[model samples]
Target: MKVFLWNETGKEKEIMLEDDQITVPADKGKYIYEVLAEWKNGEISYTFVAEVQ
Candidate 1:
C-alpha cells in the first residue's frame, strides 16, 4: 500500500509500508500522513490490506 508522509520536522525521509509494518530509517525524527482519510499522525501508523503472498 502507498503511505503519505509529511516531514513534520521538515527533515527525514518517509518510509514505505511493507509486510504490515512501516519501516523507519536508522535516524529518528517526526512525520505525519499527508492523507488523512487513509492514515493518522503518530509514532507508528499501520494500514492493513490483502495482497498476493
Candidate 2:
C-alpha cells in the first residue's frame, strides 16, 4: 500500500507501507491523505481530508 500526504503549498510526500499504519508530520490546518491498495488483479485508492489543530 502507498500513502500520500499533501499540504496547501503543494508540498507532498509518498510513503510505502507493508501493513496498514503510517505516521506523518502535519501542520495546523487542512491536509489531504491518499491511500492506494495494490492487488494482484487490480488496484484501488481512496482520499480523505485531515484537519490538524
My TM-score estimates for the predictions, one after another, are 0.34, 0.68
Off by over 4 Å in 2: 8-11, 16-19, 24-26
Candidate 2 lDDT? 0.77
lDDT of each residue in 4-28, candidate 2, tens digit only: 8876775388866656786554658
Instruction: Please give the distance, in angstroms, between residue 2's alpha carbon in candidate 2 and its true position after superposition.
Output: 0.6
Give all candidates' CA lDDT scores.
0.45, 0.77
What lDDT is reached at residue 49 by model 2? 82
Could you list the CA RMSD of all candidates, in the order they appear? 10.8, 2.8
| Poorest stretch of ten by lDDT in candidate 2 | 18-27
lDDT of 1 by residue, 1-53 (tens): 45654553642344566775665444444335432233355344453332222
Q: Show the colliding residue pairs in model 1.
A: none
